[model samples]
Target: MLDFAKGPILAIQEFFILAGQAVRNVFRRPHYGADIALQMDTIGFGSLPIVILTGFFSGAVMALQMSRALAQYGQVGRTGTVVSITLVRELGPVLTALMVAGRNASGMASEIGSMKVTEQIDAMRALGTDPIQKLVTPRMIATAVVLPLLTIIADFTGMFGGFIVAYYLLNLTPAQYWHTVWTALEWNDVSQGLLKPFVFSFAISLVGCYYGLQTTGGTQGVGRATTQAVVVASVLVFVLTFFITKIFVGNVVS
Candidate 1:
């Protein structure tokens, strides 16, 4: 049992170690502004289409499904309220983070894992470069900066999607649908939505880097690292969101 528990315990320790070093690099000299910009473009701009598509559709579906339930209570007009609250508070952040994790986390693992097997990372270290500073810190900073922005975009697009459903299917006036959507959002909902993505960004970026840096066995190991990065990053998004929501729930209740 000790042997069985040791591997996971060690892995957790290593992950936190990597996280600390990456964060420390953020404040140190020789800032990789160009690399950080590149990662933002890659992780943020590259992800826009999917994030928008998913956000829009998720809101539309939520509005559609919720309309029926509201209709049962003769409250179909409140579809926008339900759609806005659900999308902003929960669905937008979770889905956007998952989409980013699937795309960038796997990409990070494969890119770094390939560099690892090719000895490029080793060569950097020999040249007096810290791989964590050059590689990990920039990615971490980029994700942290852009994730909240992306969540905000997702929230608006989702509300717009809900508006489309409410306007056409439910025959709600534009003023009515938009009014509910706008008013349904409290500061707490917005804060929770933004905060969840920011927290998930660290998990997604770091998990990928951890798996990539740990990769061995050459090409096959790269593939394994990529898969593990996506799986772990995606899982962490869900897990982190749950805890975040729980905390906010407690605050709201109080």
Candidate 2:
């Protein structure tokens, strides 16, 4: 049992140590502004299509599903309320983070893992370069900066998708759907929506980086790291969102 627990405990300890060093490096000198921008473009813009598609379809489906239930209560016109609240409070950030994790987290792991196996990271260290600052910190900053924006875009696109369904299939007026969408959002919903993505971004970036840096066994290890990064990052998104929502729920109850 001790042996069984040792590996996971050590990995978690190393993960936090790497995370701390990367975050501390954020305020240090020799800032990699260019790398940060590049990562932002890669993680943020590269993710837009899937994020948009997921948000749109999820919202449309939510509206479609909920309309029937609402209709049973003669409240079909309030589909926007259900769709908006669900998207903003839960779906938008979680879906976007999961999509990003599948795409970029794996990419980060593979890229960095390849570099590690190739000894490129060692070469950087030999040349007096800090690999964490050059590689990890920039990715972390970029994800942190860009994720909330992606969540916002996802939220709006989702609301728009819901609006389309509500307007056409349900025969809800555009004003009515938009009004409910706009009015359904409370500050708490918006706060959590934005906050969830910001937190998930760290898990995605840092977990990927940590696994990449830990890679061994050459090419096979790179593949393993990539898979682990995506799986862990995706799981963390769901786990983190649940806790964040719980906090908000507790606050609201109080």
Give per-residue CA lDDT, model 2, range 1-254, as digits (tens).
89999999999999999999999998999999999999999999999999999999899999999999999999998899999999998999999999999998999999999999999999999998999999999999999988889888988888889888998899999999988888988999989888899899999999999999999999999999999999999999989998999999999999
Give me the runs in candidate 2 sitting further than 4 Å from their true place.
none
Model 2 TM-score is 0.98
Off by over 4 Å in 1: none
Query: Mind giving the per-residue lDDT tens digits that candidate 1 earns over 1-254?
Result: 89999999999999999999999998899899999999999999999999999999999999999998999999988888999999989999999999999999999999999999999999999999999999999999999999888888888899899989899989999998988888888999989988899899999999999999999989999999999999999999988988999999999899
Candidate 1, residue 188: how far the Cα is off, in Å: 0.7
- Write out the backbone clash pairs for model 1: none
lDDT agreement with native, every candidate: 0.94, 0.93
lDDT value, residue 160 of candidate 2: 87
TM-score of each: 0.99, 0.98
